[model samples]
Target: MSATVFAGALFAGPVLAGPLRANANDVPLADIPALVLPALGETLIMVGIVMAVVVVVGVPLGAIIHNLARDGLFPNPSLHSALSWIVSVGRSLPFLILMVAIIPFTRLLTGTNIGIAAAVVPMSVAGIAFFTRIVENSLRSVPPSLVKVAKSSGGSSFQIIRTAQLGEAVPSLIGGLTINTIAMIEYSAIAGTIGAGGIGYVAITYGYQRFDNQVMLATIIILVALVAAVQVIGDALVRLTTPHSSTASDRRFARKVARLDIESANAASPV
Candidate 1:
């Protein structure tokens, strides 16, 4: 099984490369840079806009949903269920259908539903729904015991969320954002068929249609580099924000309380 899996992975790249490189000599080398940069820029624009909208919209929505337990503000099961259904329906729509279905509205807003701007509308909307679930999951991972501790100490819902819950989940939330950003890149490629100008568009226009294999190969290399850069930066940020392994403030506090209990027990023991 292991060997089979390895063999499959090994052969996949060459199989894909063969067709991509079949007519490599026909593409103009001079046009490669021009195509590459514009495509890269369009991808960045789409992803950036989507990321911004997701953060602005998803985080607040998640915070609200996370606060929907019996002890939460406005703890109505009906409302919670309704909202969950809506979010679920949003998530259930296939991406391609959602893109096409939203074209009329996208056209109205962007003035041309067949370009990069139009693509952004659907991409951003999809991202908001998708990342909201991620944010909600991250927030929910904050332990109930921790929330109780904060409440026992007179913390309000907002205060507890602001000080403890969000702080505890920052690392995970950052990680999710990194993953979502990578996903946005993949979606941008898919959006190319609808006239979204990215490396994907370049691939379809030159590689598939014109049979310019060189353009296709170069575009693939550029995408690989872009994804690599995002991953490296994300990893560095994750490492930087995470607490040092040597830090034991939580353990020290527990120990201090335990020592006090021991001293009290010794004093109360019969002579």
Candidate 2:
């Protein structure tokens, strides 16, 4: 009975869904190229704007938080605690909830609370808090020894952070950014619910709503391709920026090679 019901549900999904089958034939092959291409461009623009806003705001905010010394400049435990709490609250909110909750702000910015412009508000807000944490974590991971060395060389706190800490933290920060960008792509789908047009919107409007399985399948393929492309680019960037092997590993390999050479010399000399 359960198997029969499951099969029925799967078979009935397209029939029961209205928009899923709407005038798909009305969408010309030529029009598809025009529609999808422009949508892709809009999505990229939205992502770029959000990424820039988040980075600009998040990086400085994180730097300030990470640099909070026990007795240094701008030392305010209460402020730090408050900002951290705010970030926590933002992260805890589901993306859809955040989108709906910020509708008024979206209206204020975009005048209609719909489309790529409206999507930017919630997406960028969520991104700022999310990326701030990543930035903070990466900055914190910078070696204390490097900072100490900089100080011993008569470097100021600002100089140490600018020259040593940030330089060392770049690879990790880039990695975090890469991951965050990918996540934002996935999150952008929720923006479609509020009438933001992306491939996800295309999928729903012309596929799920219209019962066009081909369109849904095509959208999924495009999304998967986008994700794979991001991963490949991120990996290439990490390899280009980061050290591949540890100094200790290199030292160990050198020692093993030297020992083998010495053994070979002894064997030839005596045996």
Candidate 3:
């Protein structure tokens, strides 16, 4: 069993022993990073590549799809509906199924179906589909009057999309982007079934197979922290991009406080 397990180490992560000993149940916490860091790096690289492709392809694809709607500047209902259905199909499939089903395509593109390169193809497909909708929804949220203004000023269709639609939708798009990114990170882990290197591989090998409670616990913690950090950063960017992301009541209270401060100063001054 031990030899057979080591033989399939490609699916599992590197066997840590010689200098960096990891004993799942009995290993020192310090040695866990040796096993986990490389996995984390793989996850990051996979997600990063997927997002870059999503942004490059999905953003424009979304813009094109949205602009084909009856209410859009171009207004082509047939094209819009067809594109919409296509995107819907992409989103409807579960990621795991998407990965497995697309193995042939993945192999055709990457020339191998057992590494980060193979993982990227399915992830990119799913992510592009997911984010195209996000971009569309974000663009939809833009006020119609913004489009009207752009048109009334003699803006071209492309200009309207760039300056009026996408530019105005920055905050919402960022929020959607943040959500998509976290989802892709999860997909990368699920991509582990193909022997894609990531935190998921670590969990399966060290935690699940080896019964390494400590390593499993660490993976969980790291996953949570990674997600929280993305959310925090994304929220910060959204707030920064928005003109006045604060509540109306907050603004009103601030004005009231300023007024009171002025009154108090006047009262304190001599006649």
Candidate 4:
């Protein structure tokens, strides 16, 4: 009897749930394109604004921090320590909590605690701290000999940074920016909880609240595609900027051979 009842429930489950599906207001497959496009646009806008702010502000702040540290170009330990502490604190906070914590500042900046404009403030703030660390690390990784050469040439601190440090660190910096941009996308989704509109909002409103499984699935697919695209583009840029090791080695070998030839010729002469 128990087996029979189990079989009956299993067979009846789909039939019982058919009534719920009758509601035509639920997410339909045909409407997914229209629904997803606006959210995608909004997400792009939020991330674009945040990245611009991060590049403009974070890169310089990071460069300053790196330059002021011990053995840095400027070597101001006091300023470096203070700035490092602040960046540490900012980076330590969870982004969601950071968003809520900065509501007042967001409101002050955008005059409203809701929408893409308001979301930009906290997103940019978080991005700045994160990207600053990335930039600092990238600059730090630059070959010290390059900086020494620049200094020997009577280059100013700014000139050394611009011509040697940043120029050498381009590949690493691009990689960092790629990671930061992906992180901002995640934060943007979380921002949807506070009336900031995007795919997250759609997922929450239609998928979670209305129990539209199709909408939820669609949103997931869209987000995955977006992130994948970002990573591919970032990787391509990094590859383009990075020097090919084989080519570099071949050039180094050619230079060594040329130098040996010159030394042999000079030694053979009456010098």
How do the residues 66-90 of candidate 4 rate in per-residue lDDT, one tens digit apiece? 9998888889998899999999988
Q: Distance from true position, residue 169, model 2, in Å? A: 0.9
Ranking by TM-score: 4, 3, 2, 1
Off by over 4 Å in 3: 1-27, 247-271
Error of 3 at 233 (Å): 0.3
lDDT of each: 0.78, 0.77, 0.87, 0.86
- By TM-score, the best candidate is 4
128-186: candidate 1 lDDT, tens digit per residue: 77888888889878786887788899988788887667778887788888888887888
TM-score of each: 0.77, 0.78, 0.82, 0.83
TM-score of 2: 0.78
After superposition, which runs of candidate 4 have C-alpha atoms over 4 Å from their true positions? 1-24, 245-271
Question: What's the distance in Å from true for residue 244, model 3?
Answer: 0.9
What is the per-residue lDDT of model 2 for residues 6-49, given as tens digits with 9 covering 90 to 100?
44456657566443333436455446667676766767777888
Model 3 per-residue lDDT tens digits across residues 147-173: 999999999999999999999999999
| Ten-residue region with minimum lDDT total, candidate 4 | 1-10
Worst 10 residues of 2 by lDDT: 1-10
Q: Candidate 3 at residue 55, lDDT?
A: 95
Error of 1 at 176 (Å): 0.7
Error of 3 at 70 (Å): 0.6
